[model samples]
Target: MPADRPYDRRRLLRDAAVGAAAVSTAGLATGVPARAAAPAPAGAPITAARARRSGAVSFRWWGTAGWRIDIGDRTVLVDPYLSRYDTGLFTGRFNPDTPLTVDAARIDPLVDRAENILVTHTHWDHFNDVPHIAVRTGARVVGTLTAYHLGLAYGLPAGRLAPVKGGEVLDFGDYTVEVVSSLHSRNGSWSLAFPGVRVSPPPRPEKISDLPEGDTLAYQIRVAGGPSVFFTGASDLNERNLTGLTPDVAMVASAATTSTADYVPRLMAALDHPKIVVPVHWDNFETPLTNPPTVAASDRERLDDLIAAVRKASPRSRVLLPEYHTAYHF
Candidate 1:
């Protein structure tokens, strides 16, 4: 493996325990420590005035596949995992036993209000902070039946969970969320990390791997008089499922490799070549949620490739690279 590309998934999975321990210790010494339990850095929160600013709906990237979408006083969070806990995934020593955690100090300031939480999948990076957020803000958790069961297992109130198996058009007064069945991004061998689903509530999740992929789903959120935005936590998708969505903005996740054939072109064409394409899920999730987000060497390269592909496939579509905690209006 090259020194620059620290996070080779196949290599990380193949590494022996002894070698992984050594690398993990070395990584902790050299890499940025996980700050989910530490005090949030200054200037991390979106202010009240800016969050609820009059005219347009506000969207802020929270790293990974996380996003905070504020539609007036009501807020909708999509995969809002702010913990960013170090699981050794990006340190060349992936540990499936990393305990789940949440830092209210880090998440509270930014997500003061929310009406709903849209989950794409139950992966740790996407769902670890979800249960806590759902309980904290009293927001309805919407996702697969697996997500509902998992939320129940996590002690979330039963009434707070809304399970869907895709193709559900839910009206939330000012806005609507149309659920679409989707596929998770594949690894080198076209496999997922922890693939499975919880048909019923199981034991309380204690570690990272406990949260399975739990099936993948995408969401298209459209504000009554505003723009319609599409969000997917993973890179791969079923083109047929996106037929007539034609969202104004699409939050496309960057893939680890070109495993999905013509990913950009297919997605662009599927969504009628969205007007604005925002690349997401490209940042390193093991680090702190700070400004100038941390992008591993491999992720940076993939992001560049994704951006170029978008430009080539959808020349007219505007691509916006989001900065953490910064507010963006369509």
Candidate 2:
């Protein structure tokens, strides 16, 4: 909390309560704001956007484990993978030669004015195509050491890349970011199922390491006007491990065997019980992924269940699981 922080617990409770109501309205009609917020601020405002959120705060899910968190003047993308996931873009085959083929055209507008891109790990889906965006926009690439170099391979200057170790923090124009520890897994496919339905994931590269992605990381961004947002790259939440942090919003992963309602319940019960939540790492592939299994409609249904569970687990928490490119203001 390096920033001279403002923690108005009452405002947070009110926003979460009100935001949930608005999101429910918007969710039902796809346009309703349970309640309207103030007008939006122009891009790159000299001073930080206020906590009042005069404009909107939204989460746009772009298949795979990606999200564009739009908070008025500044837009932030987290572990984005907008392309068809199975297109070898994730394997080393695509990166070393093909240049992570994303639906860049779709990505362009989402990141139209993004000042920072948070890379959760060096995994292909999270970090690969980002450098392409960074080089084109000169946006800062924030992640681990390997991610920093991988960015260089994609033609971005080292200066534009900011390497962050776990448990560290960085400063954005009007916000602060805290890096969370990530428990990364190898890329091999494993057995998975949903409601007794079974499928296998695609063939994955031989694991390069086994320490749960030494460089895998999560982030907590404390912005001026909004609540504190926490992002989980890909992890199995351990209350013992994350007990130290208090996050108002969490972006957790639910793919493969991890899509079960059980997997998320325990995790949510242990955390600070965020006011808002978003699910990632599900339904992000070109076709049926070839080991265990990948994101599918069952997974989506499971996601539906996860949302329901979140509501039950934290009655006050507002759940936001948006479709690709959809916008929300909270």
Candidate 3:
């Protein structure tokens, strides 16, 4: 079960009374707080200012699996990997023992507003920029103990690191997030296979490969009086763990391979068929953000197959393909 309500009864009652009084003063019988009011109905024309003022939830894709989610005044970043390291340079010669330089300047722009950083795993592409982003934005880092240790190794402030092994619900004033245990996408023949890093005393690795794939996590984020979004950084999912979560939006990964060919349908059913399906992590990460995103030839077939499967399994749901750095209002 989640933690008990963090508010006292008297405080709740007083807040309700104050809200009512404000509504009365504004001559509105709807009893909705001016700042907490809903935006125009779905499909209705709404400006960015109106949406923000109305406390509407918005999401901006930053290529790869990175996303900036804004719910009212709060902001949360998921699997932010904006530092597009030139992996090709390392190629067959890359080694875990070698030190890799991180360019924080490459990550600063996309993370200016992040209040919280949610990491799904410790894979390089998913976590390399996290420590720098946390340092730059003064955001709290949430992930498994492995990720926490990695943060420690990276010199991240202790006060900003939150280690959890899933099944934890966190309240951040404007929204509540539930961390659910999840599986990583299939890597070649082995399912959920990756080197596990359990460094004690925190070696403080300076190489990209030093960060191994820690426990994977999926997030179910519910914004206050707004939309709920479920995001998975990996292509695979644990259906049993996601049984009753029916988020309004599902940010599904479409690039990597999955455990089985029926992964898409199973994922949709597991999520209880979300109303909006957005395919993420489908673009090539090796390329810089300056270049228009292009679906890798190897991933194109699987991406198309996933989209087709989603359409077939959940015909009523809308498939939204988000562009790089573009904000999608929900």
Highest TM-score scorer: 1
Model 2 clash count equals 17
Question: Which residue pairs does candidate 3 place in steric collision?
Answer: none
Could you give the candidate ranking by lDDT, starting with the highest?
1, 3, 2
Which is superior by TM-score, 2 or 3?
A: 3
Q: In candidate 3, what residue range of length 10 has the lowest lDDT sum?
A: 12-21
The window of 10 residues in a row where model 2 has the poorest summed lDDT is 9-18
Is candidate 1 or 3 superior in TM-score?
1
In model 1, which regions exceed 4 Å deviation? Answer: 2-53
Question: On residues 1-330, what C-alpha lDDT tens digit does candidate 2 reach at each position?
Answer: 211222211111000111211123246222222233333456555434652345455556565566676666666778765544343322212222233455676566555666788887655556555766776667788887766655655557778888877778787766788887655521212211000100212122222121013256778877776667777766454456566567776777653333223656666776677766666564434432221223333224545655666777777776654444555454
Residues 226-330, model 3: lDDT tens digits: 678999887767799897788988988873443346888888999988888877776656567653464334335655666678888987677766656655665
| TM-score versus the correct structure, for each prediction | 0.85, 0.68, 0.79
Where is model 2 more than 4 Å wrong at Cα? Answer: 1-46, 85-99, 185-214, 258-262, 287-295, 308-312
What is candidate 3's TM-score against the reference? 0.79
User: After aligning candidate 2 to the native by TM-score, how far in Å is the CA of 36 from where it should be?
Assistant: 8.9
Give the Cα lDDT of each candidate: 0.76, 0.54, 0.67
Candidate achieving higher lDDT, 2 or 3: 3
> Compared with the true structure, what per-residue lDDT tens digits does model 1 show for residues 68-150?
87765677899998978878776667778889888788788777767799999998888988888887799999999899999
